[model samples]
Target: MALGVVGASVCLLVFLAILSLDIMGFLSWKNQFPVDGKTVLLTGGSQGMGRGLGKLLAQKGANVIIVARDVKKLQAAVEYISAAAKSQTQRFHYIAADVTSEAENIRLLEEATTWNNGQTPEIVWANAGAAKPGLFLETPLETMRRQMDINYWAAVYLAHTTLKNWLYPSDASAHSTTIQAPRHFIITSSSVAWCNIAGYGTYGPAKAALRSISDSLRSELNLYNGARRSTATTTKPAPYDVKIHAVYPGSILSPGLELENQSKHPVTHELEASDPHQTEDEVAAAAIKGLERGDYMIATNWLGQLMRVSGMQGSPRDSLLWDTVGQCITSIAWLFIGPDMEGKVWNWGKKNGMPAAPKS
Candidate 1:
């Protein structure tokens, strides 16, 4: 009984210390970026998470530009967002363009800037993505390529185009005079990017690529902003405050999710059954909340949070103490839970007979 009391006291002391550190860290972090009156450009806004985010941003008084391939759906989404607008000045627009095409993404940005009175978007959401779930051998090469193009390359193109257009200009004179606002670029990855399951071979890798790119951009932007601020000649405007956020969302109930579920392996479903499945609105709310808090890494669910801490690779830390605790938990899970899960997956695959790889 005395030992138990000592252990409990130690645990309470540790918890209090962590809580104090988190509070101090939160206070010292960058100020929250406001969404009100900002122009936000969102891709894949025709439905699901994109549409939900659009509505929420609109309600927050942001001028929202939604881009997607489906004209009908885009139009509907715009109308819905317009109805949700909190202010008369909060305009909602739609662009019908394929984000998978670099040229089309350029065109989409051109139109968005033109509509926003030649100003670039203050917040950019690279939310367009697709998944083709199957065993590595069964899925077609073209299908995997398409997923990469849509999920990875499209985001790259948009981020590149946005940064080039907003940060750099053809004329050096104009670049010096540009008054920049705080900018945020958000990329949507999946929880499976870090926690690779058997059925998500293509999708997992693509999202993982996105997370890597986001991390790289975050580092580069930090350096760029620091250098520009340090070398200011009193002529150029202060360096742009650009932030990159990577989101790892678990199961969401949306049209895209439903389609993914239809083709997903039974084992994949069984393994993920315990994780909470959020609605589109729930995901959007969580994502926006994370953004408001200036979190470098956003996880929409507990499972995503676990995967994030477990597989974290040099990303910005939100809370050192909590993150360390999560990492410890992840290590234990890897030693026990991971192996058991892998064994189950192997057994299931062997019993069910996975499809053979396509011929080269």
Candidate 2:
């Protein structure tokens, strides 16, 4: 019996090793997301991860257009992105607009389409978001509404507008051409989307909603992809294949983090202390690597990946075998981690009575 158990353990180890190698791109090295010469429109590009990713895309030969609400910041970002261009001919632009409004998002897409020489951007990234962390009751209702508007509605509106243009172009010539490269739509969500802890009630749900939308779109795009394959020999095939991806990054050390810390609860700080803090560039690089690997759900760090598998809850898995292993490991770990977090919060409340009320 002991020998039988030992043999089973060795088989499991060998299987896991092979799966690990496959997941790490050692088995397949194709760059699924090649941005060279493609036009990319990224929202929230004025600062933080948005800015970092714009530079990386520019360096990779993409014509980048960054959208943000700040004209001054957008101008600076345009310059920053231009400096990183792979060649002198690569174009860079910046658009100043508030993406929270649905009407504004429609106009934003129109302007981007015009700027791209009547072609919709091949890659659109919904990276604009804000976080307002506080106890659910203490956080103002206005802040909650604003968080949903920026973090959730903005991505929804932008994706809606862009998909309409990509799938149903008004110009007849646009669809007549045979474009082999698939288009990409990326959404920026947070690790909190998967692991909603105390003190982030206002912020977590918005990101979680974004994750749901991304998953739905990822699956829905398959319909168009299948149609394209079926009509490949015909004169009029599907316009172009669409790929949806979501990025989940842990605590990033950026200007946004500074603002988030100003109102962050002490207990929240203590709880998240073990999570690795990443830089904007580090997060951007990791996200790009995941995109290249054709991963639908991209986690910027180790902790975020664990959080992703922990609460995946029937969403599509990026790697079936690898994610299943991760899910099992995280499920066991959460047995202790979840209770420990609750106990910490419980002990803090017991020690400190009630938190001081927010000032009027």
Candidate 3:
């Protein structure tokens, strides 16, 4: 009887895990996100994939709000996206105060909420992040701190603040029967959520933080829907409607690489290089499509999935978590180019893409 009970318990646990994965998979496949006339916010939208996403969102009729510390780039992007915004509303924009600082995060939330009238950008793309590749032994503490600040903390603070200031209120205001609401939270995550192949410690940890946030946030917010909240009062259409999505994708050689690259191979030379690479425009186009469909895990670059299926573990939970997360992240090359990708991590990159640099 004892043996039988243990077996049954194991079976139940496995079944539950499978069920969760299945549900998550379904959500990942949902590509019906509505963006007809919503205000869209994109961090790091001044250049690279973020810029591409702004153009796409503008073309989709969304008023795009681009955020980045580079004022010159931001202004240039605004001019270009405004022309591209095909929307009758015309694309809009905002200069970010520096997404990595707590004060900046707070300021960004307040300012972003007021963009496009008081509409408070229904969609938020928290794609502002930075990375520095180096060996673990050589990487300076400053480098790690900067990585955490830019890639990890900045996005975290941006999401936390914006969600509290704008999203929650919007969720409160969304009406019933509104299949696709005005608000969406899309985070550009990497394929690293599933596997770890090589050079993953530094960038890997930051990317993993995003995945954990996505899993935790999704689980919590999903509960408020009709499926779990029978007596819920927050769903009576308070002011904003929402869906939080996290996109994990493969590599997209963003426009940043055209100059950043110092390669010799044709696979590295041709514009059509299929070396798991994509342009910022391509990344943005895909991201908008994913958002439209309401996909949670948009697998833009899938190297991480390979790692996840390989069945690798790191021995200790923390070690294992980072290892798995890094492998999973570096595995994917996410290039999220969207006006409002909140909490998303874009993993797409160029050259030797695995973020193989040491974490010194």
Which rank order by TM-score, best down to worst?
A: 2, 1, 3
Write candidate 3's Cα lDDT for 1-360 as tens digits. 999999999999999977875564432455466565778888888887788888887877877778888788899999888888675556587675788888887777677766666545777888876545434444567767787787778778877876665434553333334454546777876665454222334555787788778767766665544332355463343333446776655555664454324322232233223336667887777667655654555555434334333323421121234446765654353333121122222223443465555543
**Model 1: per-residue lDDT, tens digit, 1-360?**
999999999999999987886664464555466788989999999888988899888888899999999889998999998899998978888999989899998999889987987767778999999777876877788899999999999999999998876556443533654655678899998888888888899789999999999989988887666656765544443346677898888888889988988778788887776889988899999998888777888999888898889988687787676788999989888899788888888888789895555677
Instruction: State each model's CA lDDT, in order.
Output: 0.84, 0.90, 0.62
Residues forming the 10-long window of minimal summed lDDT in candidate 2? 230-239
How many clashing pairs does model 1 include? 0
lDDT of 2: 0.90
Candidate 2 global TM-score: 0.90
lDDT for 95 in candidate 1 is 90
State the lDDT of candidate 2 residue by residue for 58-163, as single tens digits.
9999999999999999998889889989999899988888999999899988999899999899999999997878888788888999999999999999999998
Better of 2 and 3 by lDDT: 2
Q: What ordering of candidates by lDDT runs from best to worst?
A: 2, 1, 3
Q: Could you say which candidate leads in lDDT?
A: 2
Lowest lDDT sum, 10 consecutive residues, model 3, at 337-346
lDDT of 3: 0.62
